[model samples]
Target chain A: MGSIHLPSHEARLACRQNRLTNTAGVAPGYLQANLLILPAQHAADFHDLCLRNPVSCPLVGKTTTPGDAHAVQPAGCIQFPDFDIRTDFPQYRIYQNGEYLESRRDLLDVWTSGHVAFLIGCSFSFEDALTTAGLQPRHQQTGTIVAMYRSNIPLLPAGIFTGGHCIVSMRPYRPEQIDRVREVTRTYLSTHGEPVAWGWEGAKQLGITEINNPDFGEPQVFEEGEVPVFWACGVTPQMAVEAAGDRIKGLVFAHEPGHMLVTDWTSNDLDKLRPGII
Target chain B: MGSIHLPSHEARLACRQNRLTNTAGVAPGYLQANLLILPAQHAADFHDLCLRNPVSCPLVGKTTTPGDAHAVQPAGCIQFPDFDIRTDFPQYRIYQNGEYLESRRDLLDVWTSGHVAFLIGCSFSFEDALTTAGLQPRHQQTGTIVAMYRSNIPLLPAGIFTGGHCIVSMRPYRPEQIDRVREVTRTYLSTHGEPVAWGWEGAKQLGITEINNPDFGEPQVFEEGEVPVFWACGVTPQMAVEAAGDRIKGLVFAHEPGHMLVTDWTSNDLDKLRPGII
Candidate 1:
């Protein structure tokens, strides 16, 4: 229950049995995904929204049919088999009519035939890749949540999903290290590839008025030579849902921010150049 | 009318005035694009299809409103001003309810209140870029059309638009030059990016039964020590339209093969590493 080296399936088993409640570093090399479930009626529109705003919502898996628990394959880079949507994650946040209701260990009670789930690529997987490449993610070393900001960039609108400004996650690095960081991250296109913005100048272009004060997550102090580097955040779709409010029909469900669904597929599987490794 | 040197706008103007019927290599540094026009009824689904199959349909610009002649700005790398959808392309292939009508020099008489235009990225611009870097595209060097084939890869389906097998354009190069070619082309994400397949082994995986006998364009005789390289072709969407058949709601229009709409933006603008160069 308290092991850090559990495999992805075992981690999900722990969550299913109520032994583990969060999945931060569990199965470190494997991929962890953000879960978003909506009523069947909104699937096509949401699918279009993901397509239009690929940087913010890089969809990894989705249900073939509404009410189906298994993730559907669509010429995916990696395949995850034998998983249930109802209880894979450590926690699930339920929203009805676009309003937050509550968070629970599982969605078994709320699960219905009308639900369609979307598994979006999470940035958490790439952080491990970055660390392995000798680039420390600022938030992890300082033991704080990564800073997140709402930028001026507008997302492409689809159906009822009138996308709002883009949400970006921030990290700090010296100017010289930015190129190496960009190269490493560029390989993982599914998980917010490369830094979208670098330094205060880049941030301002995205209309991030303040660097230290983030809209979400805890703020961190930067080193003397560090500049803020921003990547498109996976939390963007959730924020868009919240911003859409009444426009969203029926209910929506998402993974509780830090509690992602760990997959058997490794993080390296996301790299296009390196294939069949996992 | 047949000049080799002209800006993108002037080449487009020549096409507009029925003075030019071909656009290959005319605007050397500028970008050339594939055109697709459809009715508003199928716009959302077609847009979703393009978004899903970006490799095959790298959308550069789209009409803001149905039947509008002007392109909509969406933070694109290039901007084309004072362009008319009805006659900007050298030739337009009209398809009514998914059935081929005929090719025409202009669409002024056929243009109606229900059509929407989409400008897709063309591989022609990248060929020029490759030549500048001392890597010649096989077909361009031979003074023939680029070899193309239908592959087994199916595009992700959208509403009323079931995707067909991907169509890939082929070029030949020595095995050693593959890496450099990939590196140079990787910068143009909007223009089919890098090679999807290289050599006979790669082509066979895409279900191309024969290398010399291509599904479209002229067959090429490979030079000694040369391997065939494949990049996703812009013709893929047209194939999707053909595959959809009666599923397509209304009339659709496309640029005739080898004839394209030249844009004011330079080919360098497509490179993310080199920004604002246009």
Candidate 2:
């Protein structure tokens, strides 16, 4: 607890200086975001893609102008005063013409003047909230990545970003705990609020044929009386980008799945944005 | 409530037979929808547009196949066994190359084999819920149309659906009633749920300079001690379609403002779709 509880600025500085190579369970209480950078030509479609598929993509903030690395200012984020999108993440996944190329420590060398960056809320931000509420996420207990699967549920298509199933992450909890879990997650709207599906039968409706095998993260078994709860995963944007299939210009960039950009916003800051209240 | 309390099937039948010339205050218990029909080529982009701008365009249902009017079957909507999209609405506005041409009683004359239809949830469905909860809509009280404005809040772009401000409906409520109104409205997810802004100051931040001169709908005076409450309106989809400009193929059809497609669903059915409950 002592080492993991770093201020948001120090955590981001660690990533910037390459002192922290991965963000898993680091900087508790701060909100972490999935990063996606695309050429300006696809910016509109990608923005629409996030809006259309909000449960999966939940856009936290986006650059105010294309190629301006420090354009987005997270609501109430007042730390560092100098945030650069190009070199602020622990690691980045580079894609060329919609195909995955390689992972890089920073985008300083590859970023184009035409690139637009989008910061999407990550589920990691709410895990702390769940813990605070006394519900432990199974992945944290097992010290493994959360299990993810490609569901049959089709994403509403947007322009060149067309024809892909929604990607979801899964956790198992007793039926009695489902309501409480949902209530906790509901507050984190920017970070994919609430489970889209619950119970063993629910996954079949989403078109995932196998429970034990997952497309991303490690698979887990359900305990007795436990049901599988599913949520729209941040990986969905990556899948949407891949689905673009050669329609993309030269390059697109994203954080390696589970690796993220830790922002100055606290999990509590996101919870304050509860819908219907404002 | 004698004439307005007709069941869903009876209400739709009245419209189909041209017996009931208008839908407002008719079919009080049933859900009504804003209809939009477009060429099959623009179907994917349109779907994305709805997904991207869900608050403004809550997609209740869409055709399962291109040109198939009977494709969508809302879960538990068993009232209307002989529904047809072509003649079920009281009136429709036709747009060619994104220009408003004329309003017609039915789409039968303009129907094409290359068309797809979307049924967007309307705030009209939630009015009954508000009434049931003892909060009367001001428009109903004034016997006028709901006030709508084009706010500066930019919509997430999708394909040809680019650069349009969100069009919101305004209803004034006493400051004490705002919470009750929000609570009742929050239950209707298929319909636009909850007010985006409350009070005069909130409207200005949304980029609405003149609340009195709305781009659509009739304006009303705020009662003493009443605050301006703004909710995302269905007119948003129309603005997005218009923003597409010449990109739209040949023709697009939508219900005239205040005219809608009465469906077999009840207001309770929509309220039951409460987010995070699943």
Q: Which candidate is the best by lDDT?
A: 2
Query: Candidate 2 chain B, which ten residues in sequence have the lowest lDDT sum?
Result: B269-278
lDDT of 2 by residue, B83-113 (tens): 6788888778899877889988888888888
Clashing pairs in 2: A51-B52, A52-B51, A52-B52
Q: Write the per-residue lDDT of candidate 1 for residues A1-278, one digit (tens) a residue.
A: 24444577787788777676545556778777777898898876677566545666777778877888875552254556667888888788888766788988888888889999887777777888788888878777876777888976555445556546678888899899887887777656566666666788877767787787998777877899998888877777787787678877777889877677887777556643121111
Where in model 1 is the C-alpha error above 4 Å? A1-18, A21-119, A122-278, B1-6, B74-78, B271-278
lDDT value for candidate 1? 0.73
Chain A fold similarity by TM-score, each prediction: 0.87, 0.88
Give fnat of each prediction, in order: 0.00, 0.13
Error of 1 at B230 (Å): 0.5
RMSD of 2: 19.2
